[model samples]
Target chain A: METKIRQLSSNLDPRYFQIVVLSALLLYGVAILDFGIRWQNAIAIMLTAQFVQLVGTRAVQLPRFDPLSPLITSLSLTLLLRTDDVRLAILAACIAIGSKFVLRVRNKHIFNPANFALVSMMLLSDHAWVSSGQWGSAAIGAFALACLGFIVLTRAKRAETTLAFLGCYAALVFGRALWLGDPLGIPLHQLQNGALLIFAFFMISDPRTTPNTAAGRILFAALVTAVAGTIQFIYFQPNGPILALILCAPLVPVIDSLLKGRNYRWEQPKGVL
Target chain B: MRILATIAAAALTVAISATAQAFCGFYVAKADTSLFNKASQVVLVRDKDRTVITMANDFEGEVEDFAVVIPVPTKIEREQINVGDRAIVQHLDAYTSPRLVEYHDADPCMDYRHFEMSMDSAAPQAAVLEEARKVARSRGVTIEASYTVGEYDILILSANESSGLVSWLQDNDYKLPKGAERVVDSYLKQDMRFFVAKVNLKEQSKLGYQYLRPLQVAYESNKFMLPIRLGTLNADGKQELYVYALTRTGRVETTNYRTVKLPSNVNVPEFVEGEFADFYRAMFDKQVEAENERAVFLEYAWDMAWCDPCAADPLSAQELRELGVFWTGGRGGSKIAPMPAQDVFVTRLHVRYDGEHFPEDLMFQETGDRQNYQGRYVIQHPWKGEPSCDISQYQAQVRERQEQEAQQLANMTGWDIDDIRKKIPFPEGDAPVQEPWWKRIWG
Candidate 1:
């Protein structure tokens, strides 16, 4: 019993918090907010993700088959990816978990699994698209607050990425508003978008894909923010932040190499790295 | 040989009829925007960089005092601007309006088949529903072009500074809104020009049109957006704007704001047929509130060829061209058959916006999501006539369905549950025979 307690407290996994919060958000979106996620798509993603993860685990020859990470990736895919085809949904799940095994340098995945799958499917098919503005201000505000609180509650291990991304993105929005001589309300409204919130808290702050060091992570976050802003304002495109992340994903290894430090590990303490 | 050919012809006819019934439903009443006060309607047609915009004025105010300022992405030439027929827009509205489709039940005892008939819920026969003026250049403000279109004088103005434009408007007695200067300044910085129009009293009298037709302008630019900031500058609380977008693509949605589908295709109490407008308004209000009053709701998204339950007949090619659908390839003002549906897709978007709720101009994108959707409600009227067999089981099931519909109606419109139940006409001995506590306990 003492050994069990020690083991449990010794590795207080953040995945548990993430799972709870993300599930709550999914529930809120489906039941209360009426987000456009089909039940079949959700089930297809959930099963296909685990199946892909199992295949990937065997290929990589890993000792343990951890369902937690794949579950998180599958949930994120379900939340972000919108498609009518069950085949597309299954493909997205495969790409999401499969990327972690295939696309890597020095045992580190280059892209966030969910982000990679989203960008890949979007580039490939017309049916796959992201509803970035599906979350209204009411939900955005609630989501943003909840995400911030989640970060705080978790002690924000490797949270510099999320903080820097949100800060830089907010700055760019306000800066654009100021330059246009538009009202502050515009930037405030833009910043309170739920997609941006999800990107910052869940997708961007994923420990595996971000740079190792805090400084490297911050710099990476700022660059992603700048690219996203240009795509949105200059190119007049939707889902700017999402596409920006994919575009700047290859730079993660570069950032990690330049600011050389230990890589991120799950369920680790703040000072571990 | 003659008998065989005749039999083949009859079979083909039957096949066609069956398919028609499958794909089509009766268009009952329509729930148009006449239910809302101070509603404005706009029809936007965009392909690549070219856009043709039509603004319908339910102005109901003094024609002389009515003036509108819209921002254009590019400079408009005289030939690019024209006054559109208001009847075509009403036709488009009626065609795409949210409708009620009724499906009457047959005797439960007999084998049955279903049929559908569609009609406009509220045929807005009431609506058949623009002008331009001259301008002087000064203070870096250039009146690029000016002309009279129908009953109004139009001006295409490009200003270097917002204050110059604002002063010019004020000088001309345009009565610019209080915060229009800032928005104009922003648009000017973005390299946008102002398309200003005022009632041409002399032209109006000459034309003798008591009502203002829709003002239309075709321009080529990459910005597929609507300038609502200037309109939002008005401090008269939230404004209702309906956008009917006709495109070659699937659907049009706001990039900056959530384009949500309103509560649709739900069963309501049969009596709702009489008060559909009220039901629609309440349901819409509930949805808008639920979304925190910041979403643009999609009322209908359907192909221009046909409607399942048509609120109004689909617009022909001639009518579409009159509404500035230039790509329809029927420019000789000749009528085209409404068969084999047109390439045009229609997306009807409704937004209730205030400055606080909608801070930015609406940015729209054409998505490939061609899945047809509409704000439709249903009333499954139960068979009331005597059945050839016992109808006790049918009556029991009808009571259950009625209760469920009552609950659904209450949830959708936030109406009182008891009130909905009272409105619901349940069969005699309405309550489901719930097993008594004593019986259940013993069992």
Candidate 2:
């Protein structure tokens, strides 16, 4: 019995456990809130997309951790779709997820999944993410709280990135609101109604696209947040995150090199060296 | 001379139409008899036919010195003219020496007339008629009557008279064609009304009485607080009322209320169905005899539920929680089913509008002993002497009571009742307040 128990526990991979737990939380959270197999089907599409990526690449190398892709894509899908039509939702989900894998360069996804998917959906159909559930103040508040908790529990894995994002976003929004002579109350209300919380805590902290050094990550995050906020304010498009990320993503290597203060070097085989 | 003037005027009119494509210019003439002298003031006119020339006194010439000059050898063309073409001409003095000038074609007056006429005559009429027909078709009404007067073609369709046909017409891309006028004429030529009654008796002693058919009740106790009803009421019991209530989010509720009075004779109409005729005759005689008794009230209710709160606050995070109101869930550790409270209320009143008060002292009793008491009742007339009760007075009383209740609720809730009231207004008021900040943000 003791041996059997040990074998069973040992068989459970830690990474698999992480995936299962996170997926379950996401699925059940939506289900408890009246979303059911519809959302699950969306997740299934995401998984299938991941498998497609694995197959298409034909290389066993795993991609770097991306914080915002899943959250953004899930939130966007939830907001835009009215019916639980599995096929349509899955189709959207696949496009949203697959875009991240296929449209990447230098080991980092170029665009924010949530931003790209939302903007693409808007341009294609009349679907609008602005009117999605995640845009609800209370729901956004809850998501922010959850993200904060996750960040804390994860030992502030991307604390610098988060800080930079929120700081820059606040500055941009405040400056614009003041310049427009809008009552301060209205912009604050608008801030609470958008995906600001999600972008700050999740999208900006994406490890692959963000810089490695603490200061670099902070600067990168701040720059992206500011640019995104400005674009959203001026153009009134929904792809602010993707635009900001794409603009800043290329800088990750430069920022890394600057922080390291050394030319990148590759290791050679011992005998050859 | 009059005839000559008329002929000149007619020729001028035609020339105006034809020369409408001439280049606009201002004529300048010298003030003195010197031919070489340059004119000071100028006249500005369109190059097109019938150019509206504005003369400026700044010209140095007296009226006579400014002999109306025209290019003496001007060439006019009748070729199919395109938009932008110029006229080439030569002018000569009495000395017969020619000078050349160029005049570009200007927009034609007939083009403007054509556009205006199209807008006024065909475009608007077609658009308005098409839209009206579309709306009528949507409402399942057949266009059975039509009349044309001048530029207007009025169409009458089979429709529920009291429904918002005019507003619907205006809202749904419907507009009066330009030049077509609408008139209000008394066109409806029918009076269809009916009344049904029932009664109960206790061992030959008269007990109670009730009026049937024209029943007034709440239809949709949510969203829009409006009262509705079936058709008019007469003594005949063959009339039926169809009631429909819809939410802003597209949820619909439908109910059919029907009543029938029986025939006094054994013989039935040849056109009537046998089952219906027999049922009507038996029901009528039985109801008459039972008029010396009491009355009964029956109510039936059903609901159609939609999972989406699209009609409510679309941007609300509570959309997720809204499903809890319809599905089974746990609340405070106890299992519960979804039960959304009716937020909009609709009442369909089928009572008499003929200025008569119903008897208040009447009691209710069943018509038959069956589980479903399908019968009628009759009672003593309440307003025996008073021929009519003023409808306006009753309306005023109801309005006063509603205002009082609203005021009371406002006081209790400590909410801005006035603000809430602004969001929804009575028919007499202007449009409803737009969705608020939170609603717009979330939605």
Candidate 3:
């Protein structure tokens, strides 16, 4: 028994293995529920992409089992697709997954993967993103997002950034509704239909993309939230998340570099060997 | 042989030069003196490429592009001219840019003459035919044996046949060529295909007032101006009026009316006797009264009703119930109802009038219950003290019921609810209906 345990542990660390398994399950589960028969092609492409990223780059360094990528891709495919539009959904998922790596600056992705994919599809192709799944179904996705949030929060991912993003988005939507005398309920409902919750908890709260200092992260998230909200209200376009991320992503590196540069000196811990 | 060839080449050169001078450039001539003045400028320029004309002006800046320029006639210019004014120029141009064109005096042909004739003598049909034939013969027109409209004798005449008539009538001098027969034929065919049947000739007579008046008067009185003139005699001396109405289907409904006057006016020449004068006067008076009554009703109802004058029919108690009105019987042997009211009230009631009084149509009432007279309640006039206790309280109640019925109809469709609400008569002030969230999705 001891030998078996050792052998299992040596092959792949429990945490890393858990992450890979959970990610795979999440991707397949979302594809089946949201895409049904269409998920066959999507799963194939997603696995191929994941394998390539893991083997080719050797940069699979998630510390905790975070399901942000799978959740986002699933939510995007589910919310912004019709049953027959499998090819487009797969294309969108690929763009979203690939964007995290391709459209990165320095150490972090420049835009939210799902948001980047959605905007690129709209600009380049004739495909549209439509809502699916019942409003009640959001509870499940929200719970999963909360679990992911716990992992990210425990790993020093800033909570204030997520809060700021949510706060700014809510305020802008409410303010515009009041100004235009439109029904306020519609915009509020829209927040739950897209990959908004996942982005708020996991993508924006990414440690590398977020500021190290609490106040800096708060400012970054607030700016991103404000930009996204403004794009949605003013242009009434669906590129809000991408726009928000693009606008705020650069600030993270600048902020991190500033904080780290200022506090470079390290003191030895008393209990360390 | 070389000398002969050179002579031939010189002759060809001279012929080409003369042709170019004759056809290439725009011509400038006074409208009264111009040979082409009789033809429509639009027709003259039709299908002719690369042809442009400009009006002679003292102002020498960049002039805007225009389609055509019509010169106000010398008479109008003299009347409207200031001391330094050369001529009054009427600019007709393409919508994009103003391209000023040559100006000449107004063509006398554009001024239309109004004439009216009524045949009410014994054998009125025959009288109309006889009058038409006489007019055709006096004008030297050939009456085609096969060309007979129902109760109307039509004569086909070439410009030459009617040259004497043209000489007599100043406006008729601008005669179209024989080719214009096709234009007239095409217009008649299209017009006939799209014509709306006349509902009531009497009501139409009243409607004709605004049309027969002076162009400026008619333009001011009506919200929309029809492209065609009304109460005008054609070259055939037939009095016809055209009414254009926009239908619910978004197409124009044109109704034509032949002038029908009292028997005394049949023999008189329409232009001299002013046959359409009474028709105009009557129409204007009725229109004014109708407008005033509408304004008063609108003030009380707080909104305008979509009343179709042609659809206003009297109803009995049973018929009223079918129309969705709740009813009760009353003293003085009258029927009444408590009607559902809305924010707006529109009624298309058909009523028959006897002198100054309008009696209800008993057939619309429900039978069996003598006391209530088919579920209707009779009541005193709401505005009995008002000077025009003229309109019945029952009519008002009917209007309210009609509004409620319309509202219920709109609720079923889930679309145009607001518009339907606006059109109904509500006793209470404007209040929006609060639909439950679940019902919004399901219902």
Candidate 4:
């Protein structure tokens, strides 16, 4: 198992694999599902994200330019965000890469870059929205998780947050179904959403933004899940996970303060493709 | 050849090229709700927590035997219920229906000027549909309120248990659908109340009405959803439903299910103009199959102020008020006003659902998306008249367009390409690319 892990993580950053997966999904959505993502908007977002990344690199006085992070952020923004205006797409990309440089806690950004941009754009303008149902409930769901599992398994030390979040979220969902006397299919269908899977395996599992200790990460995941369920079932809003991640983001610093564990750096062992 | 564009077509083209209009469609014959057997129509007017729902069923049976028990989010009073005009509902259907548009090949010798044509929906009078119900007081089921609205007796009932509601309904001769007990229990657990309505023969006679009008109820709740599980409980096959949402802010969509836009803006053969209804039905079935029978098809989404072809003149202001456009005015009905300047946005959704395919009820969310859309199928009429100038090039374009239309129709409705071609009157060998026999041997 260790040899297999070494083979997977030896040569590349995991962000590159994420970029590949998200790009393939975006292409699939555009070509097959007709997801209504305008190519002009996509290009504007891509160019603007890299531009912001370059500006951030120079402003922060970093030694080298890192295109992988911006590329990942741009791909994710394209996959999740839906809009007609080219300007909104560019604004969203700028917000995404820009927040990573501005919003920090203990040298760690508070929110996942893509999650921050999605929520900010949704709250700021009516022109931009997230279509959670865009990914649809299909067999592609399991395939998505399988590909996502590579990043989780390769970064075993950080997989706790993702696993805990999915476990707690699934438990609450099934519990609600049982309480409501709903068919099992309902929760199963909810679980199969490609957006939810992406949230579990990618956005929520961002190591830098998570609690440092395993216990703290699990607690944070559970808390976020509960809050998200309230937003969805009680308040009757869409994209509960995206909103919940932001609402719970500030607690990560507090969790690290209390738990006192190792800090994360991408270059340190876990960030391989 | 000197090709002079028609005055109307030229103006329309200039307008289209100038404005980049979000949506355009010609008014044509619509496949109205009446086309589907046992289909139900619902108009949902919502803003914030407030909602007004109008339900109309095409029930073809004895009036005394028609009864329905609906789970409402809150208890409604007598003033909350009203009998609405069926013409308005029919008009809404006409306004948002998938339409057929045709353009005559503008004297091919002259510049072909293609323009849009549209028609208005005429309101139809409400007709009688029947429901069966009786009264038997029970301990667990409490009738909180009772009133007479139009030709129907209305009652608001709150129940403590599903079995209590079921027994109360059965004891009263309501003839509730089999397996409704589970759904009733579920609704009760959610703290929902039941609204029951049945025809009153004496009221029908005194009101001098032959048909049952649509019933409207207004209430305030955070839940923007439709409970359809009960409707599917007794169905032997799939049941068709049409939901027309009128909102002050923007469009409403099914949150739990995928809302897919129906195939639109495609051209078919000119023969489709004659059988537009059949073409729509076949295309709808094809779409339903393609989505694996699990999606809600968005038939139309447009601003209430105006339509491209003005399908039914965007509903008069008074008509809008009657359909439960609460913000049109204070109660919103005084005089007939012009349209496309109003604040209301309408979204029409259609679904063919059964318990097996659609296990959960439809939950809706109103989005601030005011982008306009409509299902429009076009047909380009060929110029049968002889061309006076260098119009041979235009004729070739027409032939190619006609062949493409044949393939499109085949693709949309899954009809055989050969069969579709058989119906199309192609211009000589222009479509099939025929050549002389000598060319096959020597060239």
Each model's RMSD to truth, in Å? 11.0, 34.1, 31.3, 9.6
Residue B5 CA displacement from its true place in model 1, Å: 69
Error of 1 at B317 (Å): 3.3
Q: Write the per-residue lDDT of candidate 2 for residues B57-152, one digit (tens) a residue.
A: 111223222221111001111111111101100000000111111111232221111100010111111112221232344543334433321122
**Residue-wise lDDT of candidate 4 within B18-88, one digit each (tens)?**
11000000001112211112356778999888998887654444555545566787667667777887667
DockQ score for candidate 3: 0.01
* Top DockQ prediction, candidate number: 1
Q: Tell me the spans in candidate 3 whose CA falls farther than 4 Å from its real position.
A: A1-37, A58-97, A100-104, A128-156, A177-194, A255-273, B1-443
lDDT tens readout by residue for model 3, B1-443: 00000000000001011000010011122223222111011101001011111111221111111001111101111111111101101001001010111111123222222111111111101111222332334444332221222221222232232243233222322333232233223222222111101112233243332111100000011111121111111111211111111111111110110011111101111111122333222322343233221110000001111211111112222222222222222122222432322221111111111111111000110001111000011111122233454443444454444444444433322335465556433333332253244643553
lDDT of 1: 0.73
The total of clashing pairs for model 2 equals: 41
lDDT against the true structure, each candidate: 0.73, 0.31, 0.31, 0.72
Cα lDDT of model 1 by residue, A1-273, tens digit: 999975665566767778777787788789877867899999999999999999988988999899999999988899888887889999999999989999998788999999999999988886788887777666446566545535533544767888789889888988888888899999988887887788788888887888877788899999999999888887777888899999998998898888775555534566522
Q: Individual DockQ of the candidates? A: 0.50, 0.02, 0.01, 0.49
Instruction: Report residue B58 deviation for candidate 3 (angstroms).
Output: 60
Better of 2 and 3 by TM-score: 2
3 against 4, candidate with superior TM-score: 4
User: Candidate 3: lDDT of B7?
Assistant: 4
Please give, as one word, the docking class of candidate 2: incorrect
